[model samples]
Target: MTDARATPPPAEQRLHPWSWLFVLLQQLRQFVVPLLVLLFAGRRGDAGDFAEWAPLVGVGVLVMVAVLQYFTYRYRIGDDGISIRSGLLQRTQREIPFARIHNVALHQTLLHRIFGVAEVRLEAAGGQKPEAQMRVLGLAQALALERRVRHRGTAAAAGGGAEAASPAGDTLLALSTAEVVRLGLVSNRGMIVFAAAFGLLWQAFPERAAADWLQGFFREAMGYAGTLHLGWIGMAAAATATVGVFLALLRLLSVALALSQYHGFRLSEQRRRLTVERGLFARLRTSVPPRRIQAWFLQETLLHRWLGRRSLRIDTATGGREDDPRKLRELAPIAPPEACDRLIAHLLTEAAWPPPRWTPVPRRCWWRLFAGGVPWNLLLTTALAWNFGPWGLLALLWLPWSAYAAWRQAGRLGYAMDARLVAVRGGWWSRWWRLAEIDKLQALRLRRSPLDRWLGTASLWLDTAGAGAMSPPLCIRFLPQAQARALYAQLGRMLAARRLRW
Candidate 1:
């Protein structure tokens, strides 16, 4: 937010002078590791000249392409929208109105910060890519563009005075160092990072399987450890200790990364829009109005409960590219229960925050949920007992665990709705609450599995915009057939005359 009477930005402009350098860096990032891997493989294979020349040629081509982009791209920032023109041989043009642009983000890596420039992305709905992407721009100009996009057309007339509010606006949430550390503890980000790297390695070297390395490692290590006169018990203990140490190291790495990414995390509200600025070395700043939020997720893991913290996330109408720093996914990475409640109240005034009451699924669903996992339990126990003699019969312990889990989970499965909003909650240990406005839902499906048909039960699924393929939708499962049909019909009637928000 800034002064309402500020001078207007220039209509037409080129990207920052260092645009080519940033573009080259971005291109090189995607191929640098792959080229290095190839070089290493080639050297091992005794192809020295090819190994050395390959990276050189790749970098040269990337440089030429980056330079060409810098010379060809041009854009105009107008009062109502932005017009972008690019390409030489196949010139492509895009005109995005400010009203249509739901998200505006600015990204600054360590190098960009040093150079006083940022990458700006403007994203609208109904696209797999951002509407406009400026690889490099002065930070001030980028912020100005974001402001213009926010206060555009009719909004400019109605909310022009709100721009004069304090530059920082009203602080909604801010994370302290301790809170960030708690977030690291609650998250499994270290494992995610390790898995991503392992997947990348597999992509680069298809023949190299993790099972081969692990099997060979255990065989060799067992033989060597046996030579030291340590029996099976000692080897088991040592291996367990090693694994524990490795997990500890991973957690420490996660903490370090969390500190870097969310060190200065702050979320604030200004002129009816929410702005979040975070990251230490690679800063990201994004702004979006509450209306853009399609769905809300409230999560509390075992660790979150232990630390007295919770996380809040939202699905927005912008493109669902998690790799893109421009997307604002986590509204609150970690906060106390009270703060989360306040946040929900502030942003979604119409929705019930704590929900006056919760309706648990029918008692018969407990048996349904419990029976669903029984076969897997028996299969696991049978396989383990067959492989490990009497000792592996410990797998039978899973039977009681699954029973209790199903009972607790079925007790927790429920949905609550008012005229304007709908919410569903699930899970026992790692619980989640999913909510969306009644009018914002894109689709409603009534699912009936074979078991459901046999038992005369049904499931109702609520689909909303901005949800990814992997993210589970709001599902209220295992209800009496008549009740499920009633809910489906009632919600359908409510959705009939109203236009979807996203």
Candidate 2:
């Protein structure tokens, strides 16, 4: 039998003594509320039974339980992995393998500053959260532990070679203040809207039920109005402007906060990997290996377009495994996509995208555009125009917009490929361009309807490993069969040349 007990644990796996501080803090919140109420309300006189005896007993019991729970918690680090054990009655144990580890992030709040401690969040490739976080580790110990684990991870990847003992070359990227600021501005419009909405809604309806009711009412009213009321139209315009102002202020504050924390941010890039280490108050570090990246989105908002900036968002494979659908961590914006095109090019060096190219869907597909139901819009507009003259003409605005959309949709729908990369560009006036390396391609599909056949065309769809859902085909309508075959053969050859695993 193997002498399992004889083997010693790795030094880096131990938990810091200050880890108890988190439990202590949590206990304070749980018990303090009741303690305050009892101490004040239950008390009669200074020496009375209600004041002295009751307060003492209640607090004593709560503190005892909290202490018990806190003490029971333990964590361990072994040669193969890290394990955490916790819980008072129903004990829970979790083990994470070093091989699956992605990034080890460190954090410290202002409160943590007082205690000279920080938190550790382990980013793993298969976890629900981007990182599994635990608070109140001694800062130095946490850093040492992070280094050890990360080293171990690297060693494992290299097949336990001698080189693993030595520190690996840089695998992080750091952003300058200017760069961080620019990225923040480009990526923060949604955050601005969120903050403003939060502030305004909190002010308007402090209670949950009231807010819910108001939100529902607003949604229904907007749907019913359907661009008809001139009086409300003016009010809506003013409200939008007001919202915009509030959002701007909120965005500025948010940017300031982000800048303060990630003031001297750095990102280290490695072969097939990236590690982002940032934050001042609560230092954050996250690493991403290339294989974990699920999808990439390039955002160009109205503000970004005006500034000629673009933001890049990358989705990872390790997240999105939980019942709570709302919470998912996105890759923090790296840079304006155009600015980082060189990096993008390097990453996609194995595959090259030709030029920005698009093709139009045949005119036969125009009937599908009215799938949203023609009667409602037509009837509503007719009634409004009959009742209110020029106001009714406004309803027809959607026609022009829809027609323009279809035209742009036809114009914007195209795909281009070279030996290394494939580019899919789609959408109308607001276009989206997706670049996928041949190695990452998951599946391919070819679809042709009766109409498409009659038009002598087919839509080609490429599924990449990281996409959320499969999109509509890359419609190459009215193309020769020879051209389609040639494109497919080129992509196949590229994939084969790279010896892609999947």
Cα-based RMSD of candidate 1: 5.1
How does each model score on TM-score? 0.87, 0.66
Put down candidate 2 lDDT per residue, 257-311, tens digits, no spaces.
6676566665565545565656656655555565565555555556566656654
Give candidate 1 misplaced runs (Cα > 4 Å).
1-10, 31-58, 153-167, 198-240, 322-325, 382-386, 468-470
Model 1: pairs clashing at backbone N, Cα or C within 3 Å: none
> Which candidate achieves the best TM-score against the true structure?
1
Candidate 1 per-residue lDDT, tens place, 154-257, comes to: 44322223343224478999999999998887788898888899788777664557668778998998788889886878878888999999999889878988
TM-score of 2: 0.66
**Ten-residue segment with the worst summed lDDT in candidate 1?**
157-166
